[model samples]
Target: MTRMSKSESRHPVRKFFLFALIAGAVVAVRNAVSDKGGSYDPNEANER
Candidate 1:
């Protein structure tokens, strides 16, 4: 049998945070898109 190295250890907490961040970003984008109907305009700002 081979011994495991320190770098080979898995961290569940780290994985959870990474997944949460990606999921949050996706949800935020989805909400933003849905709020403005189905079209997305890069140059159309609320200030202009």
Candidate 2:
């Protein structure tokens, strides 16, 4: 019973890491797209 409870407690920690990993991936993709200059020129903005 003790071991079962310990293992059950680890489940939430595993889920938290999984969620963090997914969120990090989403942020990375968003940054990459925004930096790619698809619609705006970053150099022009920097010159100002």
Q: What TM-score would each prediction reach against the true structure?
A: 0.57, 0.56
Global lDDT of model 1: 0.66
Query: Per-residue error at 19 for model 1, in Å?
Result: 0.2
Query: lDDT per residue, candidate 1, 1-48, as tens digits?
Result: 133343334546766888899999998997688577644654454433
**lDDT per prediction?**
0.66, 0.76
Model 2 alpha-carbon miss at residue 6, Å: 9.9
Backbone clash count for every predicted candidate, in the order shown:
0, 0
User: Model 1: runs farther than 4 Å from truth?
Assistant: 1-8, 39-48
Worst 10-residue lDDT window for candidate 1 reads: 1-10
Q: For model 2, how does the per-residue alpha-carbon lDDT over 5-43 read when each residue is reduced to its tens digit?
A: 898687898878889999999888866766764435576
Clashing pairs in 1: none
Per-residue error for 46 in candidate 2, Å, reads 10
Which runs of model 2 end up more than 4 angstroms from their true locations? 1-10, 38-48
